[model samples]
Structures are given as C-alpha cells and as structure tokens.
Target: MTRTWTIAGSLSVEPATQRTDLLAEPVAKALAALENHREEAGVAPIDPELADTAAFCEAYGSPLAASANCVVVSGKRAGEVRYAAAMVLATTRADVNNVIKRRLDVRKASFAPMAEAVELTGMEYGGITPVGLPEGWPILVDKAVAEAPELVVGSGIRGSKLLVSGALLASLPGAEVVEDLGKV
Candidate 1:
C-alpha cells in the first residue's frame, strides 16, 4: 500500500489543515547519505504533526508505542567526532556510558542541548531523526524497538516524517540493533 499523510499545521494555526512533503528536509539528507552509502531502505512521508511521537500515533491511528523516535546526540565523547544519532522507542532512552558511549568510544556523552541539536539537524528540537544526519554519526536502535509494526521517524524536513515498520526500518539503511538502552 502506498502510504500518504497530511501535515497538521504548526501550533499557531486555527483548525489548521495543511500539508507538506513526507520525507522532511533533514530526513531527506539522511536518506541520500544512506543511499549514497548504498543503503537500500526507503522512507515514506507523512503529515508533519505525525513527526511527533504522540502526534504520529494520533495521525497514523496507531499506538504511540509503535512509533520510533530518533534523537540526535551531540557531545558524544564517541571518537573525536563528538556527535551521534541515537534511535530508540518512545518507551526507552539511550544508555549513555555502559553501552552507547562505550560503543561510540566516547569518554562522556550527553543529549545535545536543544539549540545545538536544532542547528545541527536543521529541524526543530523535538523533530530530529536518523534518516538524514550530517553523516559520520552512527544510528543505533534498541533491539526491542526494532520489533514494532510501524515506527515514526523524522523526515529530514520539519514538515514531514516517515512511517515504517520497525523490521523494515532495521532492514533499511541497516540500522544496528543494540541492547541495554534503558526502558523509560
């Protein structure tokens, strides 16, 4: 089935009904990189409000538990790169030291501040996803989250997102399945 969605306009509109591209701008860049790196995964666009975990649930008529949210982590002591992308379920949080940080080879790691994350991702603070990162950062998904029916991820642009199966997402772009990411 070819999936499609309509964006619920930003917080300032009245009974806002607007639409934009499915794959948000930032997500588009990430897909291009993955494609360039030879990732075979494809991203589907959806209404921008669906970009949020809860909004995604309501718009797609799916449980929020099934949505996949991607967070861009900055200041990862993971190598000298200092930045990374951490993809996990709304039900969980990325483990910093014991797993993620260690894996990234960073001595210290923290979620990038909202402003920094926004500037780097080129998307709003709550709208970052792994689909279109600036490159170099790795995408780590919780193994459990990897099993949901469909997940909502940023579309690279603030105006859209991709709704996909956790399995398909993992298969696409070869997302890594990691254990120990904390369940929240």
Candidate 2:
C-alpha cells in the first residue's frame, strides 16, 4: 500500500524516492544517500512560476507558517570565505546580518548572490534547499522550523516541493538547531 503524507499543503505528494525525475540531480543524490531515512521525505509537483514562498503558499493552499525557506549566505574572514545555509519559516526572516554573521565569525555576512548560490548548489534559483549543499557547509535550522510537525521546502527544483518533518530536517548533514535564527 502506498503511504499518504500528512502534510499541510494541498500539494499532491509522492515518495521522493519514487519521483526522482521531479528532483534536481543533487537532490536525488542526496536523498539516495539518505537510504533508510529517505522514506521520511515526500515530493509534490508544482508550477515553476509559483516557486516563490508567498505565491506558492497562496496558490497551493499551503499555509505560509507550514513552509520553510532556505537561503545561502557568505561571509569572508581574513582571506577565506565561509558559506552556510539558513533554514527558517516562511512567516519569519532569517537574521542574516546579526545572527548568521556572528555564527560565521566573519566581519560581515550577506546573502550569496543568486548566480553564485545556484552555481554552487547546482540548483535553480529560488529552489535551493539545505540538503545537497557542500559537505562541509553548515546548515542552520531555526528553532521554530526545527519544531514544526511538517514543512514544505524547496526540492532543488522550482517544479516541485518537499514535504518533511522538522526532525528529519534537523537531522540532515551539518544541520544545527539554532535559537532565534529567524526574526519576525
């Protein structure tokens, strides 16, 4: 029997393992690497044009509070560059300037340029997720997001979204649950 996902959105979800074509290459590889944990994630197709958080939630019947957004940030310290992924709820914004800057221990930190982020992650713009990032990159999951029952997040492609439990997200490689990582 096929399992039904208890996700909040009106999206039609299928096990990500069974719909590899809807996922970006890096996302498929990462999910495959998860092995036993892969079953906990599900994917749903969407109109690529509605990839943005607000538009997606409004059009797909997913509550904004049940969606998570991932952003890539870069900070330069001395001569080396440090990069990290910040995952926060759609209802809140990542504290990039204050929290992430300090966490990266750089003089300053800012969102990575769109071109650079897409190139580095091998994912489309606006569809970047914490999964499949560079092996050593830190993934900061906001406390609120980490506590959610389930969340809709980018699937590395604008054509689909992933439905996953917060615990699953918090357990991804290099994920760290940080308090107050997001701000209203």
**Against the hidden reference, what TM-scores do the models get?**
0.69, 0.96
How well is each residue in 67-183 modelled by candidate 1, as lDDT tens digits?
567766655432455776777877777786567677667777777788887787677766676665665566777887667655556555556455555665564453677876656
lDDT of 1 at 175: 62
lDDT of 2 by residue, 66-112 (tens): 89999999999989999999999999999999999999999999999
Best prediction by TM-score: 2
Q: What is the lDDT of residue 41 in candidate 2?
A: 86
lDDT (CA) per prediction: 0.58, 0.90
- Kindly give the stretch of ten consecutive residues in candidate 2 with the minimal lDDT sum: 1-10
